[model samples]
Every structure is written in structure tokens, then in C-alpha cells.
Target: DVAMPDAPARPTTPELLPPNRMPKRGRGGSERGRIAMLHALAHVEYSAIDLAFDVAGRFGALFPRSFIDDWLSVGADEAMHFAILDRRLTAMGSGYGALPAHAGLWEAAGATAHDAAARLAVVPMVLEARGLDVTPETVARFEAAGDLPSARILQRIYTDEIRHVGFGAKWFGYLCANEAIPPAPRWQSLVRTHFRGKLKPPFNDSARARAGLTRDFYEPLAAE
Candidate 1:
């Protein structure tokens, strides 16, 4: 038999996610920007569900066992979210691919893929947390417009998402404490450095405050 040398192992970098989960941009780039944004958001939420499951399964000891349960719930919720958006789009005679969506959310996920702390920072804490802040306006708009069904659904999503961002805050704090990163300031700095978008003002303080945001986190943000 011919001798064969061992194959070199592949490196997993944040710049590129695992091959199967790589995010492709341009799924929703077009005139129907709102629908495209909806499509993109649903897909990213779906992807977060996958990340949650992996963490729950592979690192059970590191994370509370229930983390898996939480992620699974989020997964189910994401499916519903996708379905809702899909149905609405279809009602308008358009669908998920009808427009173009840049892969901003998943690109950030990829950026922090190599480190769990980074992942937690970029995904749940920054991205999903933003959802909590922004969702109330969406919900209120639905209510004002007499879109009761949308309002109801948005209410549920907003509530559950608060807990999800709370998970990020909890985990982020825990990781910082363990790593001796001086939890508070470090968290503020990391979120600021990695997150580029200015958090739009007239923000949903009540919803965000409910979602485990500390005064430290919001005060500076309010100042901005």
C-alpha cells in the first residue's frame, strides 16, 4: 500500500463562516426595498437559530443546558416570522427573492464567527438587541394602521426577542467577567467598535430597557 500523508486541518476564520452556512449578498437588491429588508431579516433570524442550536449542542457545559431550549424556541419563532413576511409579500404579489438584500446581518455573524464572545457581541447583543429597540415602532405602526394581525404578531416577537437579547447581555457579561475584560466599559467599547450603524434616536426606551439594557448602555447611546 502506498503511504499517504495526513491532510492539513482547515482553519475556521470569522471572515468566512463554515462553508455550509456562508451568507451570500444580493438576495433582495431592488426597488422593493422594504420587502427585501424583510426577507433579509427573516433569513438572518433563521440563521441565528442555527447558531443557537450549535452552541447549545456542542458546548452544553459552557452554556446552561436550557440555552438550547431557548434557541429552539427562537428557531420556531423565526420560522413563523419568515412565514408571516412571506405571506405578506405574496399578498402583494411579490416574494422573498423579489428584491435585493445585502448580507449585512450575516456578514457581521461571519466577522465574529471565530470567537464565541465576538459572536455574542455582534449577533445577539448588537443585532438582535437592535430589533428589540426598533420593534415597538413597527408594532405601534401596525396598531395605528389597524393592522391588528401584524400588531399581535409583532407583540409576541417583540416580547420573546427581549428575552433573547437578555440572553446576549447575560452571556456577554459572563464572558467578560471570566476573561477579566472589566465587564461594563469593555462591553460598551466592543459594541461600539464592532457596531457601525448609529442607533437611530427617538428610540424605544421602554422595550430596550426591559430587555436587560443597563443605564450605562443606554445613557451614552441616548447622548449620541
Candidate 2:
């Protein structure tokens, strides 16, 4: 019966900045660059922990128990991701709060807060799916830089994210089915309305297909 907060509680440091104002995290080729990359990722994982739980807390009552189960699992995965990244940062002589993070990470959550389907459409289906598209390149860069441990970590996270996106697609389809609406168009509409960013190209088609987030849902939007 408790109400969801407008935004999640944040740590005092790593001063949050607008996406445009955030400092560039350079290519993961040098120690400084890698540390910056890891810290940014750690911040993402930390914010994701709250995003997953907020979905459960704010919208769980509208769905079956399985909804809560799925999101709680995602939250746990995010927690583990944050912990490992923080450890990696410490090993590299940096930590999570040493750099500013993108403040707009939670903007999607706030934008879609009123509708569970929109939340799914924007948060996991759009945002986390973007991770799948970009992470392989990131892992390769880490490996090329001789940062095998960080590469492996990114690889593991990439695999888990496929499942998380699958969950979003699953539940979004379920909700659409319940409403007798087509999932793809509905998802497209929600993304257009709730997501502020563009659906960039060079997408990972195979990985997205594996997660059931086909191009039909996003391609039309991307073209628009």
C-alpha cells in the first residue's frame, strides 16, 4: 500500500549530470579510460537495481505473481552487476562514486510511471535492448586492451540482459493480449511517447530476435 517515490534515492557523490553535460568516457584502451567506463557501468547497474524493484513495487499488483518474481530476479542480477563492477573499479584504483553519471537514466522510469506496459516498452525493450547492441563492441574493446576480466564481466552481463529483455517482451505481449491489442504497434506507440532517445542503428538483430524483441516493434519507429 505504500506509494512509489517520484525518484529513487541516490548516493551523494558522482554528481549526477544531464546526458549532454556528462563527461566523455573515452575508449576502454587505457587504464584511465577503462576505469571511467567501469565506473559508468557501475552507476548504470546501481540505478538498474532500483528500476527493477520500482517496477515490481509500482506495478506488481496489476499483474500476476510472476511479474514480481521476474522483476525481483532482475533486481538481484543488477545488484550483483553493481558489486562486481565496484570490485573491478577498486582493483583498478577507482570506485563507483569517483565520476559523474547520467542523470537521465531514471527519466524513462518517471516518464512511463503511469503505465506498466509503457514502462516495459521503454525501460527493458528499448533501453536494455540497446545494451545488447553495443556491448559486444565494448567487450571486444576491453579484450583488445588486455582487460580480460572486464571483458568477461561485460560478456556475462550481456547474456543476462538478453533474458531481462525477454521478460519485458513477454509481459508486454501478455498485457497486449489481455487488451486485445497488437503488441508491436502498441510497443512502437509507447516508445514514441515515453522514450526521449532515438532507436539508433547497427542493432544486434540476432540477439534481439533471441529476446523476442523483433524489428517489427522498433524498426518502424527508427525510420520515423
Candidate 3:
């Protein structure tokens, strides 16, 4: 059985904002900027703990027992990641909720709540996969600034996110196969229907490929 309740609401602190109103995550040149960025990453990880559990609880009944196993593991990893980030923030004399976070992440979850396929497409495939593309540079920035501890934390999250994305792609493929739908085109259609933004490029194709989300799954859908 899944371990969490259905669609638990996020916390009230950190003063959630719409995506447009959130401040820019400035380059990690100053301690203030670095703390803000860590706070942002912490918020994402905290929200992800909910996302992993929500997906498992809300959709687990429709799939095999392994589905719950995989997602529950993902949730555990997200929780660990959040704890690490929050501790890192405290070590920096800051912590989670010290900065504002956007509510767009959970909004996407809510939009795809009823469809497992759509949920997989939007959250892990699109959003978590996007993390693969960007996190390397974030780690590098921290490293270049002589912030090895923070860089190491982000590097670990980057590695784990690859597997999280793999779980999404694997389950999505299973459902598509059972339904006699093709993977790539169906993914495109789902993104068009459920995702609010365009699929952009310069994607981390190698990392995506490692996660079973190849160019074939997303390249055609890239905004031209």
C-alpha cells in the first residue's frame, strides 16, 4: 500500500508566490545570493517530497506494487535531499522559508491529478528532467566560488534525480504499451494538453537518455 494520504497540501510559510513575481536567482557571487539560491533549491526539494508521495498515493492503485515501491523510495530520497538542503542552509545561517518560493510546481501536480500518464509527463519527465539539464551548471558555479560543500550537495541531488526521471519514463512506457499508444507521440500530446510551457532545447540529451527519456521522446516537441 502507498504510504501517504492523497494530495496533501503544502506548507504556508516561505510565502508562496506566482512564478512571475519571484525574485531572480542571481549568480552565486555573494553570500546573500548564495543563501537565496540554496533556499530556493531547498524549497524545491521539500515540495518534491510531497510530489513523490502524492504521485504514489494518488496513482499507485492503478499500477503494480512495484509502482508504490519505486515512488516511495523516491519520496524518501526527496526527504533526505530536503533535510540536507535545510541543514546546509542552517550552516549558512539561513534556512528553508527564508526566501519566497513559487507555487507553480504543485499547481502542475494538481492539474494532472486525475491522469497518471499526464502526471508522469508533467512532473518527472518535464520538470525533474529539466533539473538534469540545469543542475550541472549550478554545481559548477558553486565549485568555482570555492563552495565545495554546497556543490557536493547539488551534485548528489543531480545524480538521484536521474533515477527519479527514469522511474517516470519507465512507468509511462508501461502504460503506453498497455494502452497500445506510442511513447514519443503520446508524450508530445500529453505535454500539449497538460503542460503550460514550451519544451525548450539544449536539453541534456545524454542525461535524459540515461533516464530513458531520449531525444525521440522530446526533441520533436521542442519549440521551433
Candidate 4:
């Protein structure tokens, strides 16, 4: 087992801002707006690569080999997602570093760094599951703007993210069972303890169910 870094290295550009300080990203209604949206998405994917690897490196020893295998595969997927998004940004005449991004994405990782179960609960189950919730409409927005290539990229990422969340849910259940705890309430408890943000609704129930993250695990915590 290797040591995990407290944070991932990032490029000097794309000055990071607090989420509240970040500029509003309107719908992809114009070229500039679309670039902003894509850039932000690229940043998320970039950060996710490190998040996946950190989980493997930091907590892999506590779980089975399959755990390391799954998270490493997730890291690879995140890397690919970032690469394609960065390429798309370049094709659009704007690159990832051209705009500012929020640093809040990594905060979830920091909050749950101590426990693998908590990490799994908050990162993939809550954070990445959120991607499942919102990505369809984001794709539709790109399609509405006549940006088929970008829309297709998001669609592909959305599909891969289902499996990623599944990995998290699967292993979290494994951990819960080992400790003689019920999976759903254990997940909810971990999330409530480690997650900083509210569980917003309009959730994609079908996609979440496909990931083994059913309403039982999250619906109780949904924001009213």
C-alpha cells in the first residue's frame, strides 16, 4: 500500500474560486456559454481522476482486491472523460484553463478521507450519483444548442458513471454486511455525517436504481 496525497496537483490556470464566488453558468444557449459549461465539466472529470485513485490507494488495503480493481478502472474512466472534455474544449476555441472553476468538488473527498465506507457513501453514491441525476438535461441542453458532439460526450460519460456509482454501492454494501449493519440506513448515516451539501431532488430514479443506489439510500435525506 502507498500513501495518498492530501490533494491532487492541478494546473496553475483556471483560477479556483469558492463555489459561491464562481460565476453563473447559464444554459448552453451560446458559444461562449457552452464553452463555460464544458470547461466546468472538464474540471470535474479532472478532479475525479484523483478522487478515484485516492480511494484505491488510501483504503484499498482494508477491502478485497476487487475493490482496488474497480477503483482503478474508475480512475481510468475519469481520465478518459477529462481527456475528451479537454479536447472538446479545444475544438470549441476555449480550453479548460480559460475560465475559473470551483474547488468545492474535492471537499467531499476531504470530508470522508478517514473512512472507506464514508468515502464511498459521499463521493460516488452522493456526488457522482448527482451526475446521474442532472446529466440527461445537460445533454438535452447541448442537443438543443445543436452541439451533437459535446452532447454525445456527455451521454457517454453518463453511461460510464452508472457503473462507477455501482462500484461504490456494491462495496459499501460489502462493508456494511461485514460490520453487521443494514446497508441502506448505514449509507444514509454515513452520508449525513460526511456530506456537506443537501441532497437535492428531481433525482433520476431509474439511473440511480441501475447503480444499485435506490431511493431507500438517499430519498430519506432529500431536500424538501
lDDT string for model 3 (41-145, tens) is 888888898999888888888899999999999999999999999999999999888789987788899899889999999999999999999999889889999
Model 3 residue 167 lDDT? 100
Q: So what's the TM-score on candidate 3?
A: 0.95
Where is model 2 poorest over a 10-residue stretch in terms of lDDT?
99-108
Candidate 3 — worst ten consecutive residues by lDDT sum?
1-10
Ranking of models by TM-score: 2, 4, 3, 1
For the record, the alpha-carbon RMSD of candidate 2 to the native fold, in angstroms, is: 0.8
Off by over 4 Å in 3: 1-7
RMSD of every candidate to native, in Å, equals 8.0, 0.8, 1.8, 1.0
Q: Each prediction's Cα lDDT score?
A: 0.61, 0.92, 0.91, 0.92
Where is the poorest 10-residue window by lDDT in model 1?
5-14
Tens digit per residue, CA lDDT, model 4, 1-224: 45788898888988999899999889899988899999999999999999999999999899999999999999999999999999999998988899999878798888888899999999999999999999999999999999999999999999999999999999999999999999999988887888878999899999999999999888889843
User: In candidate 4, which residue ranges exceed 4 Å CA deviation?
Assistant: none
Which pairs in model 4 have colliding backbones? none
Best-performing candidate as measured by TM-score: 2
lDDT of 4: 0.92
Clashing pairs in 3: none
C-alpha TM-scores of all predictions: 0.71, 0.98, 0.95, 0.97
